[model samples]
Target: MNDGTQVHLRLVRPDDKKLLEQGLARMSPESRYFRFFSAKDRLTHAELAYLTELDGENHLAIGAARYLEDGTELGLGIARFIRLRERPEVAEAAITVIDEAQGLGLGKLLLTMLVLAARERGITRFQCDFLARNKGMHTLIERIADDVRYGHESGVMQAEFALEGPEGLYRALAGVARKEGHVRPGSGLPKLETTNDS
Candidate 1:
């Protein structure tokens, strides 16, 4: 992190329902709106289950956390991709960083991890929809992707980009993952692999 705090990243599990709920509650209204596209005070049971109980192949999620002095972990953010059955090579992706964790480069780290995981699962393209006012997300996608196509619907902007692109795309994402002083050795961002279990 920019402030020297270490963040740990891992595959999200079914047991993370409470963590996700608490994280959502802690987010600012604007953050929540940008993420969920609405003002939400809390997540319902079904939503929690759907978010946490991932199918691994079709739906995958990675979470970031900060460890406290007492060994408790604070949920910082999550990035996930859900494969489209009709278009298995492409997936709908989303990332959410809590208000306090925003602008710390956590979003980039999470997105890089998400892209790696999605590629491992045979996802070649990523599509995302965000509010037109969310310039941060737009900039992040443009910075890391190449040959991006965008469309506008109502107040939302839909972006689609290839995960496997020219050499510059690989370099851009690698540069983000290897950002100086942001990611350190033994920071707990693990290598992703294929799995049948959610």
Candidate 2:
């Protein structure tokens, strides 16, 4: 985690489907299970379509990419929130980091980006589910979210958050801008692409 590598945060694009699949291929079985709750290795066509084509208003995603010196981009992790149809102010959240990027603060960075993006879209709450025995997930939830409520059912843990507390966040970040179907500067990635969501 401490390779002193710099990771750039960027919005996911429909064109980045190959990148997403490659990243998924690098994940371990345990990592896949932790994220999907299943041993699913590859994303289905529908799932890939769903993940890349985001509306930004209801479904938002941000990815962490490490730009290599050779100009290749390696996706380290991704975090996203999908707003509920019946409750637009609340969204279901999920995050996954590759084995190499697990504890290097990529997850936190991506989550903070999601928070900012969700805040801009009028989403005030987020909910996520994880395995009951995932201590890393518990620690992450405890670290960023202050008013988290947890419930357990059928050996799975569901955590909900109001998304406004834990005072000191990326207060210094000037923030990301979404305009004209494209993500503006300050997203860490300079070559961000746009999606045709309309």
Candidate 3:
């Protein structure tokens, strides 16, 4: 692919179920472990189905793609959001990218898109929790803000990224990631783009 093949972001569709499954299957063992916090790689089909019940107005999905001129999906990055019932001004975040597509800043790009969507939905803040062993997830979440909280007993790290108005979460994330040891996505990979397996 040439540099002109841009990565675009949009909402996920019902048709994306297969692509979502493929994205899960393509994950490296370590990536899967970090994503699901498993000792091994095994996601039940039911869980995958339960994961993609995307409803844009209530629950939101942000998708990343490199499309052909005809609009075929070449690669994908996805993030899910859950709007809080009691607190409509906040949303929870979960994100993923296919292994081969890593280091293109897809994670950063998807996250920034989600942040914007959250703001548009009247969300004033964003929150996410991930396993400590999921260093990439930790690093990516930490990218959004320096105010991160760790729960050692549960191995979960929580982050708060303010999403009020036009405050750019991506800009804040890029800034913090640079100063606070947030390795650029490429730094985690080998010479090839493959994810480092456990």
TM-score of each: 0.86, 0.85, 0.71
lDDT of 3 at 152: 57
What does candidate 2's lDDT look like per residue over 102-169, in tens digits? 88766776677677678777889999899998777888888778879999999899999987954234
Per-residue lDDT of model 3, residues 66-184, tens digit only: 65779676546677789888878878888878777776666866676577666656777777877766677777766755555555546677776676433554445434433332223
Point out the higher-scoring one by lDDT: 1 or 2. Answer: 1
lDDT of each: 0.82, 0.77, 0.63
- Candidate order (TM-score): 1, 2, 3
* Pairs of colliding residues, candidate 3: 143-173
Look at candidate 2 and tell me the lDDT of residue 159: 97
TM-score of 2: 0.85
RMSD of 1: 5.0
Highest TM-score scorer: 1
- Provide backbone clash counts, one per model: 0, 0, 1
Candidate 1 Cα outliers beyond 4 Å, as residue runs = 165-198
lDDT score, candidate 3: 0.63
